[model samples]
Target: MLTRRRFLLALVGQTILGWAKNLFAQTGVFLTEQEAPEAVFPEATAFERQVIKATPELREKMQALMGKFKPSIWEDAYTTFLAKKGGEFLGYAVIVEEIGKHRPITFVVGIQPDHKVHDVAIMVFREPYGGQVKERIFLKQYRGKSVTESFLPFQSVRSVAGATLSIHALARGIKKAAALVQAVYQEGKEGGW
Candidate 1:
């Protein structure tokens, strides 16, 4: 026979275990390499990974071009996946992680070869709220934005009603990612940097 106290304790323990399971299950890939290509370039048949190392010279160039230091989420090196169809370049997909209100949001920014943004997708939104940033309507605003453009929340980019922090974080991240692509791929091709 189980006492009422024992039953209550058991229920609490089960609830804790359930939350623990959810936390552990979320540890896998947020923006997978396989999915980014498909999302950014659905018609593409092949993709290539372009790795850019964050050397001091490269960092200085990026800072100068962006007018600020690189976002902290970026590492010493990062990858930009280029999508192609039969050798015809489609665009590039770059994943950038930014700190949301209380958690990190991992997103993929697709940039065309012309330096304009193609699309934006939230691969993983860890916060309890602010998942609204993933909506198509919100993400569409990023299309065609470039490193030369400014993404001001509530001005150029519409801010989510309750997810202002997330909106700002994503807008900043997108700008940084676009600048990185421009500095490495576009400028390199043009000036042979």
Candidate 2:
């Protein structure tokens, strides 16, 4: 009942399906949007979304903080969260992304009012080999890091062997997040939330 032509057609269909499945598997979502904010600010009872635009001045400031390498994934607008507990301001959380090898890796970075990193969480990872950057051991290094601190891998932040590019990407994203929050939430800034 099985002819050669039919068998070849079935084989091709299965191969195509397998390739699609493998491509899907390379992208992983570790946390949802709701969970990311909660994970970064566990004690906060409420979160307020704040949309901030990238003005020319703000972009210059970010560039100064980031040095030579600019974040390629930055957009004209950004959405950050203000976490509060009992009506008291807790901190700010911002989602940022940077290219990891071939794909973008997204992260949620929490910054305290004092401009220090409180916590960090990975929302999505689009690369297959660099998922190790999402591990707690790698993420904990960013805690307490201020915008003035250095994120150089192997110097301040440790590196994962196979995830070197990912480590660099995360370091850039964290620094950019901290800088953005500090610039936007500064006492005399136009849009201080």
Clashing pairs in 2: none
How do the residues 89-146 of candidate 2 rate in per-residue lDDT, one tens digit apiece? 9899898888999988988999888777899988999886767778888788888887
Candidate 2 Cα outliers beyond 4 Å, as residue runs: 1-26, 187-193
Q: Each prediction's TM-score against the native?
A: 0.76, 0.79
In model 1, what lDDT does residue 18 have? Answer: 94
Number of backbone clashes in candidate 2: 0
How many clashing residue pairs appear in each of the predictions shown?
0, 0
lDDT of each: 0.75, 0.82
Using lDDT as the measure, the top candidate is: 2
The window of 10 residues in a row where model 2 has the poorest summed lDDT is: 184-193
Q: Judge candidate 2 at residue 182 and give its lDDT.
A: 61
